[model samples]
Target: MIGFSILNTINTDNDDLSGLNEIPFTVSYVTSIHRAQGLEYKNVKLVITDDDKTNMTHDIFYTAITRAKENLEIFWNAETQKFVIDNFEEQTQKWNKEIALINAIKNNK
Candidate 1:
C-alpha cells in the first residue's frame, strides 16, 4: 500500500500503461478525464484533450479541472485550433498565465 507518481503528458501512440504494469504497487492509468477524478499527485501532468470554446461544457473538462494536490503541468497539441486549460486552484496558480502567453505570442507585431 504505497503511492508513487509519474505524470505523463505525451499523447503518443505507445501504450503508456506498459511501464505502469511493472510497478509493485497499484498502477492506475486514468487516461480519460472522467477516470481522473478524486485523484491527486505531487507531480500533476494534464494531457490537453481535444476540447475548446466550441465545446467547452464537457465532463472531461470538468474532470480535468479538478485533479491536482500540488504542482500541475499541461499538454496541448499543435493541431488544436482552440484549447482552454483550466486550473481549479486558480487562487494558487493563477490560471491565466498560459493563455496570456499564447495570446501575446499570437498577436505579436
Candidate 2:
C-alpha cells in the first residue's frame, strides 16, 4: 500500500529507543533520529509526523535530514508540505548564501 516494496528491506528488526538497561533488550534496534546519531546502516526511512517547520525548531530539521547513509525517505501530510515550502523559501536563502561563500573561499584557496 506504499510506493515501493523494496522499502520493506529497511524495516527495522528491533525498535527500542529507551536504553534503560534494567529493561533488558528493552532497547532493541530502531531508534528515533535523535538517538540514532553516530550510527550507520544500509537504509533509513523516516515517517515525518504532522508537526512541520512552523512548529519544530531548525535543529530538528537539520538532525532529521542528516541521519541517512544511502537511502532516506520522509513521509508527511499536507501540513508538513506547506510548512516545509514556506520555511524553506524563508530560511534557506541564508543557507545558500553561506554555501556560496564557502565555495568561493575554497575556490580562491
Candidate 3:
C-alpha cells in the first residue's frame, strides 16, 4: 500500500460544496495527452509504445513536441527510430536537390 495520507472533507450528498470546504486528491500525473494539449512544460518526455506508434500521426507528434518549452525527448523502439531516421534522410536529400536547382537557375539569369 502507498504510504500517503490526506485530510479532506468529502460530501457524497451534494455535487456543489455549499457548506463544505475540502481538499480532495489521491494521486497525480494520471492524465491523457489529449487532455494535456495546449499546456506547456519546461521538459516533455513522450514514451511511445508499439501500439501507440501505430496510430501516431504528424499532427500528433507536432502537438506533443510543441508542448515542451525547452526540451522534448521521444522514447520509442528500434522500429520507430529507423522509420524516423529513414524519412528524415529522404526529406533532407530532396530539399538539398531543390535548393541546388534554385541556385543554378538564379546564377544563369
Question: TM-score, each model?
Answer: 0.35, 0.45, 0.48
* Shift in Å, residue 61, candidate 1: 1.7
Whole-model lDDT values for every prediction: 0.57, 0.64, 0.71
- lDDT winner between 2 and 3, please give it: 3
lDDT of 1 by residue, 1-109 (tens): 5666554556677756644522348554555555667776565666655654334444555566567667677676755424343333342254378777789999995
Tens digit of lDDT per residue, candidate 3, span 71-93?
88889999986675565567678
Q: Pick the candidate with the highest TM-score.
A: 3
Q: Give the TM-score of candidate 3.
A: 0.48
Task: Give lDDT: candidate 1, residue 28.
Answer: 45
Q: After superposition, how far is residue 106 of candidate 2 from its true place, in Å?
A: 26
- What tens digits encode model 2's per-residue C-alpha lDDT throughout 31-107? 77668766765566666666534654466666766777788777888778777767767677888999999999999
Ranking by lDDT: 3, 2, 1
Candidate 3 residue runs with Cα over 4 Å from true position:
1-30, 84-109
**Model 1, stretches more than 4 Å misplaced?**
1-30, 49-57, 78-109
